[model samples]
Target: MSDTAARIADFIEPLRVAPGSKVRLGRDFDPRYRAGLKKREGVELLRTGVALLAEYQERLAAQDTYGVLLCLQALDAGGKDGTIRHVMSGVNPQGVKVSSFKVPSTEELDHDYLWRYARRLPSRGEIAIFNRSHYEEVLVVRVHPENLVRQKLPERARGKDVWERRYREINDWERYLTDNGFKVVKVFLNLSKEEQRVRFLKRIDLPEKNWKFSAADVRERRHWDAYQRAFSEMLSATSTPWAPWYVVPADRKWFARICTAAILAHTLMDIDPRYPEVSEEARNDLLAARQELEEEAPSGAAADPYAARTAEAKDEHGAGHGRPARKKHGRG
Candidate 1:
């Protein structure tokens, strides 16, 4: 396979492994898969991708009929934050939303496991990214079965068939979303346990990243083997043709981000959203309004103070500095 194709294949190959499977993709799949691109023409493609996805954001936002759902699943310290930040940098925040799932709250526990997730689903003409999502209930919760009891699934629904049944439900749920105009692109950030240990240690060693470490993280690492088994089983069961998984290698953060952006760009283009054309009457009305605004708009500086402040802010910060400042290093 070509390098990019091989990268993609390596990511998805692990999903085919059954639950409790002790397989490692980094070794099973060639680590040198992307080495050939190091001094080659990948830069031009990456630049082209930036402009292409920007245009896609415009077209996608204009369609107003469908939305893009980005599902990012990863172990702790696997670069989920970095992937989202770099890969989605080109997209307009007005048309994009992100939700980070945390431990269930009292209110969240009262509803079905998927209830909290459904509330965060994307609206038409927007993109929604889940840093970690409903898949956690299957992966993490499976390893810690007590979580299943906490979610309050009836004892009957929590039968021996629970895991398989959850898979079918998730597949049906995704198909229903697709049929109703949602395009789902799921990415699993696959980092080796050894790599993760290095990252976790970095978090503790780096002053800025120290807040990201917690006692719970250390505790979770203790259950690493169980989590892997759960993840393998979850992927094998839930990966469908409609909502397939892309297992991104997290050993290299930049490469993983590039792969994610490529996946998003391909999915958006496949949907073929386009900007709506103005009708003749609407065009004339716009022209007339433009003329009137030009006549009435105060000459040089008085167009609007709010507009002036916005312009000054844009010039001060780089373009697309809409949100408040964020810490440069952290984990969520």
Candidate 2:
């Protein structure tokens, strides 16, 4: 890693949730933290990180051994879309799959909350991004406990032990994935209530952004405190070594993008994916194929197969032989 890369990695270290440590979302992390980087510098760093991430993605695709799952959770206007747009713009689209979870359908509701998300997990050699992930079940549903009744759980399953059990299930699930060659990266874009309000205002006031505004988004702001508490509890209980959470400060969109790109770049670098090695026989076969191709006549040369075939046909037909001279056709 270069000095800049090292600095970026160091800067994001504090954002990571330490395993088994209590996390107080509002008290521990500042929404406006910027590591003293100005907007221009942050954007430059973000571009660098994005370039490195693109390279890493290519390697991961070629290696085809492990997968990366990036889960992004946030409140309304928290910049999940923007982060995905900017950070992954340079990566090969074939190697990346993005799934945005919305209100579940009847079929999805019939299964466990995690079932739908599990179906979208990244395949080996691919990067999968969840715009709003399974965390919503704990955060949004917990804040609105009434939503659970619709899940049709038995009385026992709906008891006070539910949240704890879900937390354990989630941890175990992530550990299972990690043990089986998947790297899970969870990021929470921690934006402040005030910033969210400003963004909402922008959505309403700007014509181009008006399409993004929804009345439900404004109503959800009322449960900000509840969501924060739920998030804090979720982070505390489920941030395991196998799948850690990074609480990114998202007040400044540029800084958030840079931090997210840097973290992703670091994770991919740690995975250290590489192109698969070729056996000696495969290498020799490739060398022979290259030699055969090189020996072929270049396009437009006299030895070109198409050119030789055309000449042979002309001679066979005696088109160039002395005979009654054919009159040139004229435009009618």
Candidate 3:
């Protein structure tokens, strides 16, 4: 492996919550962990990661055998948007899609919670990023059970065990996706309460950022402990082998993005996608077409625009040393 790749793997290992490992967010992880990287160094690592991600994405698309689903979960101002913007900046837009989930619409509310997220699952050979994923059922809904009554779920499905049941359901769903060729990678941007407070203050202090500040966001702070417990439990229950959770420290935005890109690059590396190889028949067909195209070039190189382009192409092919390009002139 390249030194950079080896370093990235080492960097990400500490962030993964192994399957069946109990999770205590505050006790086990530091929100401000940057692994001793300065912002400039982290940016350089992120640049390497983004370039690797783009190269792998092209291979993944051409291979068309696997897809990737990246889930980002975070509290208010935890840098989810910035992570997506920077980590995904170099990928082809057509091969990558971002789906942001917020308050459900009336139509969305009418179906099972997973229904909305299921509709956005990545097709084979594409990447789909979920800004906030189906885990919201366990995080937000676990914290505020009042939203349950709004759902008006069937009597048997609405009980104290609902959270545990939903966890099982989500794990099963992810496992199914993995077995079928979609890799699910989940990241929780772990931000400290103090850092969150500072971000809120900054939002209010800057005129350009004022629109991002909402009074309700402050009100939500009152339930911070509840959300913490909810997040901890959700991570514990869902960090399975099929879909592991990486608790990225969001105190440093650049480091979090670096970690996310590293994780994505690793996932693509595991998939090892490659362009389809041509068959001997296809190779001969290609050679036949090349001959036809070469023959189309008129003897005089400057007459027709089409012929001029053909002559230029033939000249490029003709100028190289070594074995001659074949001509099937006498063949049918």
lDDT of 3 by residue, 1-332 (tens): 76756776788999999899889899999999988889989878889999999999999999999999999999999999999999999999999999999888899889998999999999999999999999999988878888887786998889879999999999999999999999999999999999999999999999999998999999998999999999899999999988999999999888899999999998898888999999999999998987777768689754457767897688667857563765548757
lDDT of 1: 0.77
lDDT tens digits by residue: candidate 2, 110-161: 9988999999999999999999998888988899898788877889999999
Candidate 1: misplaced stretches above 4 Å? 1-35, 39-47, 287-332
TM-score of every candidate relative to the true structure: 0.78, 0.88, 0.88
TM-score of 2: 0.88
Q: Model 2, residue 55: displacement in angstroms?
A: 0.6
Q: Per-residue alpha-carbon lDDT of model 1 for 1-332, expressed as tens digits?
A: 45644454454354333333344444443322343455235455556566667888889889798898999998898888987877767778898899999999999999988899999999999999999988987888888888888887777998988888888888889999999999888888888788888888999899999999997888999998888777666766776777877666667676666667777877777777888999999999998886676568766755556667898787658645675543558776
The lDDT for every candidate, in the order shown, is 0.77, 0.90, 0.92
Sorted on TM-score, best first, the list reads 2, 3, 1
Best by lDDT: 3
Candidate 2 colliding pairs: none
Give residue 18's error in model 1 in angstroms.
14
The number of clashing residue pairs in each candidate reads 0, 0, 0
